[model samples]
Target: MYFIGELEGSSPDLKISLYKWNAKFFVKFETADLEQVYKISEMDVSEAEVRAMVTEEFIQKIIQRFKEMYEDLGELMGDY
Candidate 1:
């Protein structure tokens, strides 16, 4: 497993790591305190190529969803 790169200034502290096993690329996204993994079968592309597919816009979308979930949970907890 090799750490390809990371995105800075992300809302939930996102980091990307790549692991190659049996000629398969495993793209791991560490967002906030959660770990999400995506498998990519393309092994002939550069690290930048993988990063391009996982764009900042996509990450922002996930972050927005997470924020909304947390906000809703907080409200529910307050009512308890």
Candidate 2:
């Protein structure tokens, strides 16, 4: 199964995709020029832990990194 969501922030808008395979869930972020992916492990952790784990600050950092990488790739590919 797959799901897609949009994440809006002050800097840039991000599109996040979720994929479920074999009971595990994976997340991918997409931008015009690049894609970034991550995996969420199904462990025996509390809901609070999960909430605390993925904070807004962390997500923003991830988005920024992905965007930077994407821009770099575009430069390398002469897509400017």
Candidate 3:
């Protein structure tokens, strides 16, 4: 499965591609203007395993941060 996420930063808008295969998730972040990319890997496991790997609080915090970033990007682009 594949999913796309948006990243907002001072530099530029970014699109993140996430691929899930073979019980792992590969996340690739792509910068729209600079044509640069970075990737990180996360192990794929059951919901319980994921919860054990990362705390719910941490996950929620990260999600909130990203959502803010995305919203900021939309505002900067006047597309919100």
Candidate 4:
């Protein structure tokens, strides 16, 4: 994967990064222990458009997914 750049406006605790690999672009949203990635075909959108896609609402959805993932982990760890 080739590092593109990081996105701004993500929650302080969350990190958002952009990458390109295999003719695709990857948008990665990560918290300390959880992460979500979105893949887009390079032909589908340009890098600038990809950045534009990460709107505030999208970040909220990513945050929610992280919460769900953490909850699932907690269940698997017996609520540890």
Candidate 5:
């Protein structure tokens, strides 16, 4: 995968990166030790469109999902 660039207006706490691999583009959001990746087909979306999709509301939802993921991981760790 080739690292493209980052989306504007993304949360500072989250590292948002664009990557290209074959016919797909990957948007990766990272905070601390956790990450979420979204796949988009090059045929379906342009890089500009992908960057435009990362609005403030979208970022808020991503942050919420990350919080939920951390909680889920905490629960799993409790089993050990």
Candidate 6:
């Protein structure tokens, strides 16, 4: 897969990347040093389409995933 571009967020380091892999598009969002990827089909897909797919709910899911990962790590480390 190759990178199409990145979307800048409110935070300087927080960003979203759009990638093209064959006939599909991949979205990469990074938060709290964790990265999450989302995939969408390429049917009639355009830059705007890919950009539009990232809903507020989806972003929240990304954040939740990060939190879950952190918790999992803490558990593994016996951090309570």
Better of 4 and 6 by TM-score: 4
* Candidate 6 or 2, higher TM-score: 6
Residue 44 error for model 2, in Å? 5.4
Whole-model lDDT values for every prediction: 0.66, 0.60, 0.46, 0.91, 0.91, 0.77
Q: Between prediction 1 and prediction 4, which has the larger lDDT? A: 4
lDDT of 5 by residue, 41-79 (tens): 999999999998888899899999999999999999999
lDDT of 6: 0.77
Preferred candidate (lDDT higher): 2 or 3? 2
lDDT (C-alpha) at residue 40 in model 1: 75
Q: Candidate 6 on 1-80: residue-level lDDT in tens?
A: 98988764425545778899978899888765667787887897787887877777777777677889878888988954
Quantify how close model 3 is to the true structure by its C-alpha RMSD in Å.
Answer: 10.1
**Could you give the C-alpha RMSD of every candidate to the true structure, in order shown?**
4.0, 4.0, 10.1, 1.5, 1.1, 2.7
At residue 15, what lDDT does model 4 achieve?
Answer: 92
Candidate 2, residue 58: how far the Cα is off, in Å: 1.4
RMSD, candidate 5, Å: 1.1
lDDT of 4 by residue, 23-53 (tens): 9999999888888899999999999999999
| Among all candidates shown, the one with the greatest TM-score | 5
Summarize candidate 1's per-residue lDDT along 1-80 as a digit string, tens digits. 65544544344466666676666677776666456677776667665677677777877776686577678878988999
> Candidate 5, which segments miss by more than 4 Å at Cα?
10-12
Clashes of 1: 0
Better of 1 and 6 by TM-score: 6
Ordering by TM-score: 5, 4, 6, 2, 1, 3
TM-score (C-alpha, index-matched) for candidate 5: 0.93
Error of 4 at 24 (Å): 0.4
Worst 10 contiguous positions by lDDT, candidate 2: 3-12
